[model samples]
Structures are given as structure tokens and as C-alpha cells.
Target chain A: MTPQRPTMNDVARTAGVSLKTVSRVVNGETTVAPDLVAKVRAAVESLDYHPHLGASMLRRNDRRTRTIGVLLDDVSHPFSAALHRAVEDQARARGIHVLTGSLDQDPVREQALATAFAERQTDGLILAPTGGDLGHLEAHTGMPVVFVDRIPAGVTGDSVVSTNVSGAAGAVRHLVAQGHRRIGYLGGRRLLSTARERHRGYLRALGSHPGPAVHDLHDPTAAERAAIAMLRAPDPPTALFTTQSMVTTGAVRALRRLGRERSVALIGFDDFPLADLLDPPVTVVAQDPSRMGRTAATALFERIDGYDGPPREIRIPTTLIPRGSGEL
Target chain B: MTPQRPTMNDVARTAGVSLKTVSRVVNGETTVAPDLVAKVRAAVESLDYHPHLGASMLRRNDRRTRTIGVLLDDVSHPFSAALHRAVEDQARARGIHVLTGSLDQDPVREQALATAFAERQTDGLILAPTGGDLGHLEAHTGMPVVFVDRIPAGVTGDSVVSTNVSGAAGAVRHLVAQGHRRIGYLGGRRLLSTARERHRGYLRALGSHPGPAVHDLHDPTAAERAAIAMLRAPDPPTALFTTQSMVTTGAVRALRRLGRERSVALIGFDDFPLADLLDPPVTVVAQDPSRMGRTAATALFERIDGYDGPPREIRIPTTLIPRGSGEL
Candidate 1:
């Protein structure tokens, strides 16, 4: 039931001009006469003629569609959204367009999306890979791929990630300095590299005392349940180090529900919106997602522009903002 | 430098088979013999052959690209991101991918991006139109266009938006019921229809007792400045009604800075992440962006699937959550 679209020939006939003249005018060539240009424009307006970018790209000398694909964990999440926006900003400045898909931590979806993007002949791809074997991507030879937030497993590529270990360590150390020896750890899925790294840091900073730890608290509800259970235990943690923003939110909710927010100190791994506006303003080790996204995009663009150097492992630093929560 | 990619001919040559046989195997034809398919697969693996979707689409009977373009104000914002994710969820279920762009409220950018998507032959378009005139889009007569979060100004199209006026009125009425006769307004850009609708609602609920108001507080910093000035004035509003999430954040910041957070009553129009964890737990009139996004996508797909119908206007309802702040 698709409507018939007006072709260039139709525009040419309507304008009483040759097909070449219509094409030249539509392409914004300098040689077209002013009257001819006006006639072509009027015809185009009346006929609603839209040029086909795919056809034009097939004839382009450079063979670049000026489009990139971005595959992320979840586009709605604050961290992923920030990264996508940063990439968009850079791509826009360079007159490029972006096609994005959410992988949802599914390796099958990741492979499918990567293949789809490749078939579409995108110039490059930037991805936050799932926690699975990336051996399937080896077949996409010469397709410039840049990983963000996580390093690729079984694949050689440039990656931009946060200093998760140190950031988590710093948070735990800050709580310890507050004389909180019995600390609780709220974290994300164990399979994610970021979560594992942060957990390592927590253990390192906790020294010999391996306080209560919960794994796979991917969502706020799960984390909230875990937090409530831990807080009600006999020897509850004096402080908590939440390894992710969602987990941090769940812990905060649990504390509020228990009316113990002021008594139990907390330091979250990632900084989120309104962190400082809470009752006892949330303390957080904030990762620079914008910087990481910008860096990943820059790396991908470089690869597409013929930078054939060795793969890079770029780690962006994090900052700890101590608000009322950590001090308490 | 772009590397040379292996063509179908190369795969045939390597597999020692006819080009037609290799093509059949690559296209997943059932008539291909198992041995011949294995040979083609081996050759494809060795040569890293990738089928070009552009060339295949030229031969496709239906000529559908199975992709759509989404234009938003800014994808990084929480509301936009949530809406985008909802659209993505629907598109993925139908095996469609999304190409997105940020218009940044610039009419020029909006036109450019729309034209670009049209040139790319996207099956449909979902737009949050800028405040400027949308007459430029009238030329895309047969293109499936669905507006989200705002109605098209001068174009005939399907649209899904929130109940802005009623939601705002509900927030104001909730405050007035709590004996707040002097309520301040923090709003977004005056040019935006949503902001104007909310302002109208506020005025309607106030019933001629026009309290202090601020317009064009598009950002938190600007809203904070306005709120501080309003609060420092001789006649300060006892309560605040912020018409946007960012505006609400600014008002919250202003109250905390003045040490009047517990004393001042605040109700925001849009709910955001961590709103429930704030000191008094932010009271908000939450708009259903996800529902709006899903509805807009469904309508656009219907049009794309050849259901040519008259333009429709769909409004999703809003919810007023009475958290502690609004009851103050």
C-alpha cells in the first residue's frame, strides 16, 4: 500500500527542464541557472521529491555513508544515555548520523545487531559489549569497532573504561576513615567486568574484614530487598558501598524505609542526578561517562580515518564527592 | 585507507563453485546442497564476506528498509531517554532499528535532520517538533510522521502527548488544598506548548490570585537563580510548582540553599530518578512518557503498514504523587 513517489523524471517534466538540469539543481551545483533552480525547486515542492541517499552513496567516491552504529547496554539508563549523547555531539559536529540499538546484555542480540549494522554498511560501530565470548565478532574483519565501558573479550579493539577498581576502593576507604569497619557492599551482576572490578576494590580496601556482600543486585528492587535484609541482621554494617547507581538508589530507599538514613553511612560508586539533594546528601565516586564516551567515539573515528595503530586501553578517572552521607 | 572487501565472486572462486550456487547459499536458499553450502560457508569465513543490504534491498520485492528515524529535543535528558527506550522496545519487537537525532530546539536543525532521514528512506518518522513552525515538513506528504510529547504546529500528522493542562492543574489544586495561596511557578521555555499549557493550568487553578512566576527557566542553574530571587523578595511564595523536572531540581536546590526545604512546599510536574529518595521525597505530577512513546510508535507503524487514516491526537494521562514535600 505504499504510495507512488515522484521520481526525478517527474520533477524534470514538471519543471520543463532536462533530467540533468533537475539533478544538478537538486544537488546544489553552482552551474545551474537561477531561473532553472527556481523552476526545479517549485517542481520539487509540488511533487515532494526526496533524493535517495543509498543511491547517492553507491556512487560516492569515498564510499562513506557518514553513519555509525552504537550498541549499548540500555539506552534509557543514565550512564548509557550520557554516553550516547556525547557520541551524538561529536558525530553531529562532524556531519555524521548515528544508528543506535540496545543489547540488553544479551550476547545473541549483540551479535545480531552487529551483523545488522554491518549489512547496512555503516562506516563504524561503537559498542558496550555483553558479558560473553566475542569470538563471533572476529569475522567482521576491517570493520572498525570501539568498545566503551567494558573491554572486549576474545577480541582485539580499542576500549575506553572507567577506573572502577580504584573508584570503589576510594569509596570503601572513605567509609573506613569514618571509622566504619563493618561495611556492606551492594553491587550489580557478577558477570559484568565493572562489577567484578569494583568488588575487587572493595575487598582490597576492606582489608581482612570481608563484610556483608551481595551480588547480582542489578535493579533497585533486588538491591532494596538485599539491603533491608542486611540492615535487619544482628551485626548490621556501619556503612555501605554500593557499586552501581541503581544499587545505590535501592540502598537509599531501604535506609529511608527503615528510618536509619542518618545512622548508617553510605558511599555510592556512581554519581546520579539529585545525589546532593537527599536528606543526608549522597556521597559518591563519580565516573566520567561523558569523557569516556567522547574518548571512545574519538577512537572509533580515528580507526575509520585510517589509524591502524595497536589497540588502546584507555581508563578514565573518577572523582569522589563527599557529601553528608559519607560524613555521617 | 579503506581495505578491500571480498566480493561474492571471490567466495565462488575460493569455493570452486558456480557464482549462482554461492549466491544461493549466501541468501539462505533451501535448494542449495549441503556440501555446496558448507563450501560456501568455508569460503565466506576465509574471505570475511559481508552481504551488502543496499544491493539486496534493490532486489527486495517489498522495498522496505525496516528502519525508522526518531527526532527528539535531547536524548540525554531523562524524559527523552525514557521515551526513546520505549520506542526502541517496540521497534525491536518488530525487527526494526532506530536512527536518532537531536534537534536541540533549532528549526534549522530539525529541517535538516528530517530531510536527511527522508533521503535515507526511513519507513516512518517520530518527532518531538521544535517550537518553530513545522510547515517545512508539509512537503513530506506521503511520509509517515508521528509527533510525540507535542503536537505538530502546521502539519497534519498523528500525535501522542501528555495531559499537560490537567496534570498541572492537579498539582496546583493539590497545593491550594493544603492552604497554599502563594505558589511560585518554575517553568521551561515560554515558546514550548507544554510549558504554556502548564502555565495556563496554574493560572486557572490560582483563580486570579496570581502569585510570583518565572518563565524560560530551561536549565537548573537558571531556575535556581530565579527561585533564589523570588524567595528573597519581600513577598515570597509559600509553595512552588515546577513545571519541569529540571525546574523542580532547581527549586529544590534553592530551598536547600536557603535552609527552607522543610519549610517550603514543592511539587514538580515531571517525576525523575531518585525523586522518592530526596529529603522530603519530592511530590510530582508524573507524565507517562513511556506510554506516549509506545502509542506514537504504534500509530507510525500502522501508517507505514498502509493503514492510511486521518490524523489522530492521543493524550496520555498524568499521575499526581503526593510525597512529603507537597504536603508541607
Candidate 2:
């Protein structure tokens, strides 16, 4: 027969330390004394002790797997990537690891990935919900959930979101103040609450004089096509408000191609890298993804730590940055 | 005592299906017939059965936990995030989950995260190593590993990297063709092989008259400072070559502040979002991060699938896109 695998008890006995000390050392708590740590290490090496995390999770009362799952629209997008990094920073600080998935705005994918994470016993979940209803997640009642970027729909939970309406309104107002009554609107899919909120803000600010508006521009290429069509149409708006960064990029390309970049005033929602360095620097209503991420993480941890308060909604404010594009 | 927990056998018996069929359904594999899948679902619900992933991992001979760990320099960085998404896409297609962490070029963090991942029984690891020696990972002999962005150091394993040296040399030659004999270099830490290789390329291409070169600009702020100092110094270089994207942003800002953006030629390595939208449209030698990421994931999955071949090194090519910036 194969030799019996060494256990934490054996290491403790060989090191002449308590089982608790062995547990602490094995769990990487970092509170043990240096000499004691060395002793435990030596004992562990000699005994070839390997702690089974699966078994430990089953044994522990708290069932702390030390892992959390995150769902985003696309992990590669600049905005989503920033939020992910922030969540990661907070999770790492608490000695927790993150498992991330890109939902890609598919409710089916969101439900399937959430179920997969639950089966793996993730301690909690942070998500930018894609579905209209999170009824599927109701099955995992024990797992704490936090929503970011968009508020939870058909569910009660902690949510951290940007000031989408006010931020978008502010961008439109900035353009209107520049004497642009005929301001075009470029936006994302209406399925997203954030997109809807931004469009609402534009309408509220434009107030009775809405110019040409296009929706469902998911990517830059689509946005570019829409911008080109609108510009070619008779009585095209002198200014434009692109509701998303990718949409903004498409609009910029369209303007550049028509040699109208200098003439058409534009303001994009969401700050992108090298925005200021652009020929006519991009003006933007910048949302703080990092702040939103940190807030969501904090709320999730609070729930995990047994905070049973009523669900809270936190909104991070946005800033309107004035650069050459909007000013023109 | 609480009601006895149900097992896969119990699920199979209740559903009148074979254990293998139950296993396939529980594991989320999509080969089960519609009728059989419906029966399995009903039985699972009635019995209130939940699969214990930990137990399943221990019981399986192939020992696939269906999870992989990824270590990146900073998950928020555009290049790193893009690469991560590519890996995630491939992994998700195979129904594998990803655990990601940011190493921030800290060797200690790299070692600690690697060990943490190993202890959690991740089937494999993909990393951009921050250390010169990967001796720390030797303990996780069972786990397959793949390296990205930079080649493996002391240890040997599968690695997918960019044409750092050749790409840098090509960028320098492009600047030379523009009649720029004096071109300063802005680079990252020499601790990284990529940084060193890039600096070497700069030196080789410059031949007899290498201008002021600065090393260890870790962020955009640092690069901006270095660029400003270099420009203000006596006999400033006629052009600048920034070896990284963040460094390029800094150099661009510095030149703008000095009111010499139009006068000095520049070419940055690594394409970022909106590089073309800049005033003079920043030129760059772009590395195919998506391709690099896809290649790394493919190599990693190959290892996990029991391709026990010798260590392999794969290099993805880079392309030079000439916008107005490098031509000045």
C-alpha cells in the first residue's frame, strides 16, 4: 500500500506546536512568529504535508472558499477592464481570488456563468447584470451579490452605479451652451439601463429640440456607419454627443473622413486612453469605473461579513471635462 | 440528523439514467439528449442535489478542476487586459473558468500567487513572469504552465511572446529613414527581458550616435518626466522612440507642453486605443496582443490535454503603422 499521506496533525506533532499553529501556518495567515514559522515549515517539509483546500472548505463552518466570481460585459473593454482591476485590488487585499467571465450582454450567458460559479462554491459574486431579471440567481441565496455599473433588476441587492443621467445631461448641456441647438446623439444598445439613462439625459437637456438620434450602435464600426449616414443627411446637426467611448471613436472616424472634424463639435461619454492627445482633444463626461468597482467590492464584502442591512444603492458622480472638441 | 445528502448515483437512480449520463449533465457538457437532460434536471431539483466540485476534482483521474489561473503585470493595463480577455475567451469555450491576479512586476507576489493557485488545484497556469528565476514554481510539478509577453527565465516551459527585439529595431530604422540621427529612447525596467531586448534594438539601430537613453520609466508620469528632462537638456535629440504605450503617452504630453509636438518625430511601441486620433496621429510598432493571448491559451490547453512535449517558444510578429507622427 502507498504510505499514508501526511496531515496537519502530523506536522503539528512533529513541530511540537498546537494544531491551531499548524493551521495558521498552512493557511498563510502571516501572524506566526518567524522562528515558529520556520519550525512549522521544516516539519511540513519533512512530513510532506499538503493541505487539501476542498476538504478544508467542507470542514469549516463559514465555508469561506476565499474566491469570488465577477461578470462583466467584456473583460477586454477599457471601462470593464478598469473596473475589474479595481475589484481585483480589493479582493487581493482580503486574500481572496477572483474568477471573471464576460457576459457579452447575453442574459443566457450571464445565467449559465453565474450557475457555474455557484457550483464551484464561490464565496460571493459581483456583476454588471445583463438580464432584465436576476431570478436565476435567487437559487443561490447564501451567496452575497453586488451589482456594478447598472442597478439590479427584478432583484434586491447592493448596487454601485455611475450618475449616468446627470452625466449625460451635463454633456448635452455643455454642447447646448456652445450654441448647438441641433446636436446629434450617438448611443449604445437600449437594452442596457446605462444606455437608456444616458439617452434620457440627452432628451432632458435638449428639451424640445432633439436633433437626429441613432441607437443600437454596439461597436465602433456600427457607430461610424450611423455617424456617416446622419452627416450625409440634409440638415445634419452641427454637434454630436456620442454616448459611449466606442461610439465616440466611430463618430470621430466619420468626422475625420468627411474632413469635418474641425467643424463638427463632439463630446463622448467615458474617458479613454490618449483622449487629451487627440488632434482636437476629446471632451468627455468621465465615469469613475475604479470608484464604482471599489464601492461594489466594499458592499459585497460587507454582505459576506454578515451585514444584514437593507439593500443600498450607491451612485458615483461623473465629471465633465472640457477639451478642444466640445469647446469647438 | 439532517436528511442524507444525495450523490450522482442517487441522481442517476432517480432519473433512471446511467452514472456517466448524470456526470455529463452535472459537468455542463452538452452531449446529453433532451429527454435525458430534462429527467436529470427534474431529479436534481426534487432531490435538492448540488454537485460538490471539490469532491469531484479529487475523485476524477484526469484531475481537471475546470479552472486555470492567470497572472498579469496589471490587469487594468490595456495590453494586459486584452491578452487576458483572449485567454479567457479560449478557456470559456472549453467550459474552463479563469482566476486572474495582478503581479505588478513584483516577484514576491508572482511566487505567492503561483503557490496560491497551485494549492487551490488549478489545472494549469498562464503568467507574465515578473521574476528572473521561476524556481518558486518548481513545487507545482503537476500543473501545466504557459508564459506570455516575455519568454521564460530560469525555468523552461511553453512561452508566447512578441517580436520585441525585431519590432524595436524596425521602429528605430523607421525613424532613421526620416533623417533622424539623434533619437532618444524611453524604456521600462531592465529587469524585464523585453525591456532589455528593446533597449538593445535601440542601440543596434542607432549605431554610432545613440542619444540620451533613460531606463526604468514604470508609468506614464515617469516617462513624461524623462521626456521633458531629455528635451530640455543641451543638444536635445531630434526625435524620440518610446518602447511602451504608457511611456509614449508621457512623451507625447511632454512634447505638447514644450510646444514641439509638430517639430519632433516619435514612434511608440504597442498600439493603444485612440493612438490615431491624436493631432499628428501617433505612429506605432504594434504588437498583436490578441494573437499573443490566443497563442498562449492554445499552448496552455495543449499542455493540460497531456501534450507532454519539450518546452516550446513561440513569437508573434509585430507591425509598423505609419501615421503622421513618425514622418515629421
How does each model score on TM-score? 0.92, 0.91
State the lDDT at B169 in candidate 2.
Answer: 92
Clashing pairs in 1: none
| Clash totals for all candidate models | 0, 2
Tens-digit lDDT string for candidate 2 (A1-328): 5254467889999999999999999878889998999999999988757787777887787778899999999988989999999999999999999999998898889988988888788989999998566886845435789999987668888889889999999999999999888999999988787889999999999888899999989899999999999999999999999999999999989999999988999999999887787768889999999998998998999998889899898999999999889988
Per-residue lDDT tens digits of candidate 1, residues B92-185?
A: 9999989998888898999888888878878889999997887767457356899998876778789898999999999999999999999999
lDDT of 1 at B170: 92
Alpha-carbon error at B289 in model 1, in Å?
Answer: 1.2
Worst 10 residues of 2 chain B by lDDT: B133-142
Q: What's the TM-score, to 2 decimals, of chain B in model 1? A: 0.91
Q: After superposition, how far is residue B123 of candidate 1 from its true place, in Å?
A: 1.1
TM-score of 1: 0.92
